[model samples]
Target: MTRQNVSIVLIVVLGALLLAVPALAAALGNPALVGLATRVLIYAIAAASLNLVLGYGGMVSFGHAAFLGVGGYVVGILFHHFRFSEPLFGVIAGSDQLLVVLPAAVLITGILAAGIGALALRTSGVQFIMITLAFAQMLYFFFIALKTYGGDDGLVIRRRSALFDLDMRDDRTFFYVVLGFAVTFFAIYATVIRSRFGLLLGAIRQNESRVAAVGIAPYRYKLAAFVISGMGAGLAGALLANYQRFVSPDMLHWTKSGELMMMVILGGAGTLFGPLFGAAALISLETYLTQWTERWMLILGPVLILIVLFMRGGIAGLIDQLLRRLK
Candidate 1:
């Protein structure tokens, strides 16, 4: 088969496998896999969003985790207020609806990203990375100081948000919900990368001077991409908060941002489905390694380094090469 055919087959197979995960886990009496898969999907969303800016736009945001934390806190705070039957800031009311909370999380995160990107976009190279990290740390500390929402201890989401007739509290159900979002987000990401705006963004990444010389403002495009990426991360954060049943400042830590960055790079930064594969590979590796030994991370570090060293485009790139070999 040609590599293109193999690629098509691989995608179909992946979809089939994702759909069967719940049933497979149930048959094996390993319900934990369902939750694990859900977590993987959520991180995949975040990693994909980061990939948009870092991979295509050449905007390396080292503090992307702050947006995730922002999304989670939005949900957490809203739930808390709703549970207490209290209004937010003595006027705005809380919401337990998934529709309301999810959109709110994405919108709020996008707004924050716009504000931060306005300044961060002005710089480039290492300076951009450092500024992003600083902003993230500041947000992390801000959440830590918000004592009303459990502060450093984090807040528990006792009840999951309402989603029409679906019970999000159920692990399998939640997994499917997340899966749907992941699939939808990937479709949208693919479309965006193929559109005019996406083409322009790539041109800007390759030659910013040329794009600017043509009278096109590169800043606006970059900022737009950044905001969209942040919104996607926010959606992932809300899903993760629901999955973990908790929200904390740790979500916004630099290490979390680093992990997201690693996923994008590891999965093949410029390719569609790279983040999903990266998330699965990293999370699954860490998870299984932990069961084998407490030093799983020690093993994982060298393993990842080896992958980066040998694989041309991370896992996705390696797969393409192998498929071509078969062809």
Candidate 2:
């Protein structure tokens, strides 16, 4: 099929799914599950952001979760210290004020990404990965040591940030906000992947030496991709803090970073929508499996191994292969 055809089909399918969400929620009669799905969508955005670096830029960052933690903590800390009642510089610091917090989270994450990428882009292969991981660990411990906002125990957001009186505390309202951001980020990512800079980054990923030989600086492109990825993760992190009404150092753990990478790989790296599918599938399976049995990880481990062993291209790649075979 042509790319246009695929795009149309995807748009149609996504529209249908979104339209059906309300009906589905009504049928299930469980607001909590709907809320859970919304959370998955937020993570999908984060995973897609990571894919910009890992899949396209050929930069393997083992500390992507730190961005999310940073975003969440920004929301938590600001509200806790700055008095959740009034706006800072005319903007509120609560969960309902997603507009205010989201940009702040993204900017902060971008700043950190720029600094970390400057050092990390100087290295390559396993060294780059280890350096990123170490930086994340350092931040994790810093948060742990912060005794002001519940520190190791985490801080609870007593109220949702305000957005023109829309109560974000309502599960349905929050779900729609997350869904909106997910779709918006997906569109932005698609545009970025097709832009000139994206093409250069793609080239660097395939052959850094050749890109450098052509007079293009591979490091700059990689750093740009890293900052973009960090911003995406930060957006998800801010939303997550609102969803959970808390922030903790655990969000910055290496395991969380690994999970982001796993989502990218499982969803078919380089595919725009792969991360969304992967996050939804993995998180859903985890949620259901944990409820079914105590040894959830035991079951999950084999499934992941099987996917790596047999489904080499992941779900999106598998779909592509099957479609080609049909043709």
Q: Where in model 1 is the C-alpha error above 4 Å?
A: 1-5
Q: Tell me each candidate's TM-score.
A: 0.97, 0.94
Give RMSD (Å) of candidate 1 vs. truth: 1.3
TM-score for predicted model 2 compared with the true structure: 0.94
Candidate 2, run of 10 with poorest lDDT:
87-96
Candidate 2 residue-wise lDDT, 74-184, digit = tens: 888777745645544566534346677778888999999999889988999999999999999999999999886678999887776666777777888877778888888
Candidate 2 Cα deviation (angstroms), residue 35: 1.4
Give the C-alpha lDDT of model 2: 0.85
Best by TM-score: 1
Report the lDDT of model 2 for residue 111: 97
Q: Give all candidate RMSDs, comma-separated.
A: 1.3, 2.4
